[model samples]
Target: MHYDGVDYDAGMVIGAELKNGKVSTQIGFSVQTFIVYNPANGKMELMFIIKNGQVFLRTIFIDKGTIEELLIGSVIQSKNYQAGNTGFKIDGETGIAEFNRLVINKDFKIIGDASKIVLDNTGLAVYSTSGGVIKLSRRP
Candidate 1:
């Protein structure tokens, strides 16, 4: 994935284990930039477990000396689609970051989180709270 002129490889499974019909795993990824003076080194960790037909996802990001975490609730998957919501906390305030729908047909699209609509072809098309509709395309 490429963001902000930096290239990031796909996440990898760091560890995995299965026991008693349950499976747990950890995935990690790194984001890096080329500039030495203005460095941007970020790491992301995702931990998930599957038990009794239920799936939970937790994602944590460490970037530029800051930490952010997202604890996603149960994931419901259908043909070429999945949806879920994650616990979101900012500045000691808490809420849910709802991912109402994610459709992956010929392209990817996500709609939720207080009127936030993100399309794979368009970075952030709508942000209601910010009152702006900015369209950014991924750099090849």
Candidate 2:
């Protein structure tokens, strides 16, 4: 498989990626939690959060054709979806896949050592041999 890379710094590029399936999403405020793994300079951080957002997917996998359907279907059936809190509702059907602007308040995180996450709540957490444990709990 050939992988071309583009680093995105905003949510709008999410849809743009659907067009090419070769992009990354990065935003400052969007990051809720992160962990660092390497300690040499603590440059490796794994993020764990995507809140009030959208999911634009395009995949050609050997197992399941478009994983987008699976993911969207799961979100639709989630308890939060049932509760009417999920931000995204099916807007319309695309010839390739169904599209939705997911705006739920969800969270998760990772850092130097990685971590567990929960969202709609916002906070920051980090685990590193140099820093030990540094965190800021979520707020309503």
Superposed model 2: Cα runs more than 4 Å off: 1-66, 71-123
Model 1: weakest 10-residue lDDT segment is 88-97
Q: What is the lDDT for 59 in model 1?
A: 51
RMSD of each: 21.4, 23.9
lDDT of 1 by residue, 8-70 (tens): 684435888998999988775442321112124353333555445555456534455743865
Best candidate, lDDT: 1
lDDT of 2: 0.34
Candidate 1 at 96: error in angstroms?
21
